[model samples]
Target: MFDMIIKNAKLRNAKDLVNIAIKNGLVKAIERNIEGKAIKEIDAMGNLVTPPFCDPHLHLDAALSVGDPRYNMSGTLLEGIQIWGERKPNLTKEIIKKNAIEAIKWEVANGTLKIRTHADVCDPRLLCVEALLEVKEEMKDLVDIQIVAFPQDGIYAYKNGDKLLEEALKMGADVVGGIPHNELTREDGVKDIEYVFELANKYNRLIDVHCDETGDDQSRFVEVMAKLTIDNDMEGLVTASHTTAMHNYNNDYAFKLIGILKRAQMNIITNPFDNSVLQNRTDGYPRRRGHTRVDEMLNRGINVCIGHDSIMDPWYPLGKGSMLQGANLLMHYAHLSGYDQIYELYDMITNYSAKTLGISNEYGIEVGKPADMIILNAKDEMDAIRLMSECLYVLRKGKVVSQTKPSISEVIFNGKRENIDFIVER
Candidate 1:
């Protein structure tokens, strides 16, 4: 007997119903119908069934750590850093692990089972790194948590920062991370990028850098990052998150940079929800959106993914670990309201983000792939995005980890009965 079976489910790209059978934690078959019996079954009823969501960039160490000691009154990235510095000394392994676990539960319920989180390793205590490493192993069954040794503070700004970063890597951090824009000077920022690349190559780990997150047009570390990726031949293995500065670059310069990014084959992740509010604090009127050139990047054949960077964290005040929320914001800020653009927006969160995290091979809804998928309470892609659709069932390794029933509504007017589906009718 098969482990589980899902019947009459509608794929996002097709109009026909399909049956999916899972056995031994893998998709055994996908066809029009299956005759074999299974221990568990779910009737999707023509709802949208898709691959599990993926979050490409996040800060689990700082998640749910907002308004600690004080709030960010200035609403600037610099102020957030200062607040984080104040709160870092109070961190303990127990508390960090507790918060990380809570955040993972939130994400899993929203159908995000694969995540790449940055853990602050700049603290001499390395408490967050130690805690997250343990959490990674503890939650490996439910979710795949890839931890990055993130230096929130500049690597070269603090004393002994470089050594601490390398130490965190030796202790089993999966990726090498840096915040070059936070360095003391532009030249120092370049040096820190080189240092991170050297360490990543030495340890044979992937590279994910927080490059040029600021609104300064002069902050051009993305070019340096691209060149390094090409020189090191680490194209698909390297990711650049929040290249917001590119938005401010002149069209000519931006076009030139895009060529470099394409040649390097680096992945780009844009955090629309956080960048929209955290950036452009200095501008009074006609303030910049502070978002990267998402449309331009996609048009150039560059792989771009959307990220929910913060959840009740120092940087962003609101988030529920929902990729749909991130995608919705991206649609608005990026002016992607066309019929085709809406569908692509969904891809940005699922398949595109999966590619960024380098987990697409094991992710999808095809036969012989891992049976990790989600059934949403919407008929198609447009309906799903419009409703920020509820996840009816979430399956991990062919086992149901969570499920939620769709909301019900009744309408009776003038002795007439009507089935109310705002998503379908509106």
Candidate 2:
């Protein structure tokens, strides 16, 4: 007998309802009906079943610390940076670990099983790194947490920032991170990219840089990152997060740059919730959204993913750690409501993001793959994104990690009570 069996599940792009059998923490079989019984069984009632969400970019060290020192009066990126600096000196390891664990729980409850969080390494103490490293070890069985040695302050502009970053990496950071556009000068920015690539190569770690997260057209560190990715033979091992400047680039330049990105096989992560409000803060009326060319890049066949960049952090004041919520906002700003595009938007939160974390090879709901999946309270991707559906059951390695009851809606119309669950009579 199998360990568990999920019945009457509706998978994406499939027509018929199917039953999946799990055994030994892997998908044992999938068919219309199973011959034998299992230890436990769940009736999905035709709800959608998909892989767990993956958040490729986040700031865990600063999560849940939005107003510790003070609220961001200006609500600009620079103001958020200043506020974070003010609060970092007063942080304790216990406080940081507590906040981080709370945030991770939120993500897991929402079905995010894989995460890549940036731990600021600009401090002399590396306190966040030490605390989060232990958190990662403590929570390894529940979620896959990959910590990036993030140099939030420019590596060259901040005093001994590069050394601090290296120290964090040596102390057990899983990724190397940089913010090239935050450097003092263009030359410094170039040097920042070079040094980031050097560290990545020397340590054989993945590179994920916060590149060109500004409205200025001249902020083009993404191009530098793409070049270095190709030159270092690390094309598919690099990620460029928040290339918001792409929206400001002229058509000619963007056309040329997209080719380089495709050649470099770089991963692009867009944080719609944070960048929607954080970016274009200084612009006047008719200001454009602070985002990359998501639709364009997606068309070019480059790997594009969405990130929940902050969770009650300084940069963004609000987040619930739900990738669907982020994807819902993305559909509006990116204008991706078309029939086919909605599926693409869903991919941004799941498969595309898994690719960013280099786990796509073993992810998904296939035979012989780990039974890591979530049953959503929606029929398909469109309804899920539209309703921001809850995860009815979150499973990890064939065991249920978290579960929620599917919501019910009752309406009293024309003096008669009825149950209406948003069904369309087509």
Query: Judged by lDDT, which candidate is best?
Result: 2
Clashing residue pairs for model 2: none
Identify the runs in model 1 with alpha carbons over 4 angstroms from their true place: 411-419
RMSD of each predicted structure: 1.4, 1.1
Model 1 C-alpha lDDT versus the unseen true structure: 0.90
Please give, for residues 1-426, the per-residue lDDT of candidate 2 as tens digits.
999999999988899999999999999999999878899999999999999999999888899998889988787999999999999899999999999999998998899999999999989999999999999998887889999999988899899999998998899999999998999999999999999999988888999999999999999999999888888899789999999999999999999999999999999999998899989888898899889999999999999999999999888899989999999999999899888999899999999999999998889999999999999988898888988889999999999998987677888889998887885633
The TM-score, computed over Cα atoms with residue i paired to residue i, of candidate 1 is 0.97
Q: Tell me the TM-score of each prediction against the true structure.
A: 0.97, 0.98
Question: Per-residue lDDT for 148-232 in model 1, tens only?
Answer: 9999888999888899999999999999999899899989999999999999999999999999998899999999999999999
Error of 2 at 224 (Å): 0.8
| Model 1 lDDT-worst window of ten | 417-426
- Per-residue error for 50 in candidate 2, Å, reads 0.6
- Pairs in steric clash, model 1: none
